[model samples]
Target: MNPAQSTQPTQSTQEKQYFDLHTTGIGYLNRIREVSPKKGNPFLACNIAALSGAADDVVYTRFDCRVSGKEAEALVRQYEDAVKQDQKVLISFKIGDLWADTFTYTKGDKTGQTGVSLKARLLFISWIKVNGQLVYKAEKAERPQLEQDPSGQASQGGQDDQAEATSSEDSPAPAAEASSSPKEAPRQSAQIALPETVQLSKDAPDFQERKAALKQQGYRFDGQAKVWRLPTDAAKSAIEAQHQANAQDWARSAQATA
Candidate 1:
């Protein structure tokens, strides 16, 4: 391996693990090379090859299958409908999982040929996660070897193209808000009454903490303008409660206070 070369994927330090079958170590995939005469004369033939993770164990009754034309489009519609209606559904493939990720295969008389022209049935079961959390897990049966089409293609049935937003956890979270105290500017709002010399200025210690405390109590700090505004009745009540508590404690005898 080149010293600088990386074995990990570019976006994350977390490694992706594949299926590991004992002995042969076939990984997580098994292939079906031949198509069988089925009960239905469909445009496409799909098979259910393997199930992975916790989701694959259950049997589903309302699965859909499509022939020759486009398995992904038809399957996605079925999957979406089932999910929306809260039904169980599985996708089958016209070819194996490996073939779905590849563009071309040379099988039988079509050796060395590109694209899917054969009447082969394949299946793949897959799970997908966003930022290490499962978003959708599914199975697909499709012929992935087709000429690039004018319409963009969805991934093979169970294959998921997780959005990058979902992978945010795998990457460093946005740098935490700067810890240095935020500078306070002179108050500019005419509505706020303040003494001329008591003008709020920048360089206050723990400004962020104070602001955060106020914010937690439903206050909004216009730091640039050096004004704090109450956002809700809760905030007004909280501020009044603090003052009342202080006054009540002050009323206690000096000896008792001391």
Candidate 2:
């Protein structure tokens, strides 16, 4: 080897981490929206109020998510139904972006606190329990190979396509023909499964904490159902106002990134 080759530094390699998110919590649905910030690609966003700490000394954590996939859609639908029917349910969610920020409340008192947020771009909700009973269960969302590659080297310029073409040459039929075949064609929605309910353990620790925190927030515990209740009250209006504000903020962020 040349002397210069030995002396030269090896460039640092950065690889994307896969399957890094696994979060499970119980929180109140702050806000939910089915929006297409970009054309054709739609996503669901939810601003959730997660509970923290003991009942006597509770901290209100902000758990928010912006995600695409069928599970997200189902979550949005469930949130809507809960809102419409005036139901309070406990949930268990996982695989999302978890973060914290210290910011002013902006609504009233102009308070500042270290609040956490969870963005579930790719995630699974293990279960949802209502009234200490299992209502729904869901599995983790299946990851798409080309959608998010850990190497960050695929799909940008068709690198993966080139390799796939070579390896799948003997896959019984050409990819183009296979895609073009009417019966074998795939729908855009097939990328993920439809949203489903969660089946959480009634004894989950977080469920109790979530119930207590929600109760502190004026949510009543229904003696009939034995579940914490969420009211279609002032908070919904307040959250919608925040939604509009977020749209404005999103526009600014998009502009900055662009």
Candidate 3:
């Protein structure tokens, strides 16, 4: 071996990287059918009228989705009869690998006009509500715990603990730790006690407006829990303030009527 060449570091092989874009929301299921393409396998496809904006002035964005996951496909197929019957089938869905496909209209009011269709693969069916009734909900898969040895003790316990401690030290400080103070600890703990998601009553004043605003700010509605969820404390504060304001307004209105 050449002296200088042997001392040099070996070049590492490049690994493949993937960029994924996923959209999750509630929508009305429509146009359910099995598409048998000339090439490749037959697949289930459907159109989703995704709901957005304020309830009073709601907006719908149509997505031409291919059912990708086996469970999602099964769930969608089960609702085909209901959809065909013209009954409303609402679902909380997750779509991935979205793209816009442009095509010329063959027949319609806009014949010979070019149109863009939003296309994506329906990867998950979070929950299904048919005609305002909860019918199907995807079960949350429990995470597998680390297995232990025959002795009921964690394998390589000491070494793993030391490694975890070292990793934590190298990582950026957590929010609680970064803002640590004698007076702030209790406040931090109280904040931590708040749930990851919150549900508001349909009868709440300006509920539609609040929902639209929160959705725009990246808060997702959890269909299963019937709640709006965001990981940030700021969102929780906003929701609390909205509730308080609603209460005060209701009280003032009652007094005036008396």
lDDT of 1 by residue, 101-161 (tens): 0112347533443221111222332342222354444433322333334787644321233
Residue 69 shift from truth in candidate 2, angstroms: 4.4
Write one digit per residue (lDDT tens) for candidate 2, span 129-162: 5433457655323322335468665531243234
TM-score of each: 0.16, 0.38, 0.51
| Cα misplacement distance, residue 154 of candidate 3 (Å) | 30
**What are the per-model numbers of colliding residue pairs?**
18, 8, 0
Which residue pairs clash in candidate 3? Answer: none
Model 2 global lDDT (CA atoms, 0 to 1): 0.43
TM-score of 2: 0.38
For TM-score, the strongest prediction is: 3
C-alpha displacement of 203 in model 2, angstroms?
A: 40
lDDT of each: 0.30, 0.43, 0.59
Residue 87 displacement (Å), model 2: 1.5
Q: In model 3, how large is the Cα lDDT of residue 81?
A: 92
Candidate 1, position 51, lDDT: 24
